[model samples]
Target chain A: MNAFTRFASLFGAGKDASGRGGSSPECRRVGEVLQMYLDGEFDGDTSWLTDHLDECADCGLDSAEFQQLKDAISRLGQPDTDTRQRLQEFADHLAGGEMDVVDDPV
Target chain B: MEAAQTERDAAFRSYVVPELDVMFRVAMSLTRNKADAEDLVQDALVRAYRAIDRFDGRYPRAWLLTILRNAQINRTRRRRPELLHDPDTEMERLSSTKSGDEFDPEAVVIDPVFDASVRQALDALPKKFRRPVELVDLGGLSYQEAADDMGVPVGTVMSRLHRARKRMRDHLEQTGFGTREID
Candidate 1:
């Protein structure tokens, strides 16, 4: 237990050593799963996160934290009226003309 | 003068003026400086005007962007380089906090310091990483859209995005926030 605590403090309990307080291996694994989960990329590996989370406390915490953070960041990044207007103008400009693509046919 | 006037008048108005803001924003993301961005956008507009009559009108935004990107690249190739300091690394050095200053959780994260750091970090990246980061994250185009724009497969976009995001996070860590959760 002492050695484990030491390992946790030194290596951040499996968190990144780069000063981002490396997350646990379990957390990283969970993060990978969550990426696939949110992307809906895996219909086959349905029980991965479920079974992993059941055993990994750190991963569970990381998952919850990541979800919350994702939500917050998404809200912060949501397009505002001005941004939308800008994009609309861009779209309109795009509708005005096509670019000439030079072809090299031998 | 009449010919020039006629050409200028017909060269375009709605697109030239209306798209300026979008062009400026994209340029800003690419150049990371307002003056340079403005210059690049202007050059791109001029180039676009020259080619506008021949344009196919298939994908105007992508086409314009390609020209703008090319202009930016051209300018970079010709221009003398300026010295840049990576703010992320500097921020990391200052993370000591011996002064006991606390970062505000509610303060805007897009402040000049963070923005400059992000810009610098992004500029430090290779062109391969820079492209997807510029397209997907800053430009807010979807993967398929960017794929079409870049003439690459969607998987390539995904790969570039994954690498770019990882590189960005790594850059952030190296500069400051070493081990701090970015998201």
Candidate 2:
């Protein structure tokens, strides 16, 4: 129907679909489930991938690291409380019709 | 007071107020500066307030972020000829602040140098790939949600994340942080 439909329906793509050049016999199919595998959501055997991780240099090195990176990246920023308070005050003012649009400082 | 204005304010409370923090963080990602991020969020809220009738009463976060992102882009285009700062540079600024005893090295276990190396590799990723990582992994958005926010499909988001995580690993391995594990 569209490019998206085409890309997604390439059914047998499995591991190569990710396009990171991680395809290999042991990790080929493994790549398809790597993200889920890292999250402990994969359906099949754990040691199947775990065994691959033990044997496959790439999977061993990267799978664990990806999890760490996910953690690291998520740790980077916080919701600014000042922004929240200001937005609240702004919302209150707008709600009360106390501020005109022409003089809006925001 | 106009009835429409009162209704809009009520709608803002029901739809917009709860998302202020999320919108602020998403705004920060786009603007890379706190003041600019706050300004962008504020402006986006005003714009959203004006367009509240158009909202479907669903996907509030995505709606606000889409507005904030567009506002930031339009403003950036008007004010500068280039991106405010590359994500890599912005990420480095983030890591710099987390340094010098605040991170509690004994608690985290990853060496600070290696930690910085990991960040460098992540920042080194192409922005298209990096942005998906931010939206899905860092931003805690579902793949479909990120897809909607970025205007791509879920498959594209997954592909981007897969490639991005793969590349980050390759970079870490090259830097010899491959064996290091985080607890």
lDDT of 1 by residue, B1-183 (tens): 556534543545644555565566567567644345656765776676666667766666777788888898787778666523335554453232233222223323423244334555566788876776576555555666678767899788777766665566566557763333332
In model 1, where do residues sit more than 4 Å from their true spots? A1-106, B1-21, B81-110, B178-183
Model 2 residue pairs with clashes: none
Query: Where does model 2 exceed 4 Å of error?
Result: A1-31, A36-64, A80-98, A102-106, B86-92, B98-119, B176-183
Q: Residue B175 in model 2: shift from native, Å?
A: 3.2
CAPRI-style grade of the A/B interface in model 1: incorrect
How many residue pairs collide in each prediction? 14, 0
* Tens digit per residue, CA lDDT, model 2, A10-103: 3323443223424577667777787866644456678787777666555554454556667665544344455467778886776566766533
Chain B TM-score against the true chain B, each candidate: 0.63, 0.74
For B101-144, candidate 2 gives per-residue lDDT tens digits of 14434424534445566557766888999888777665666677
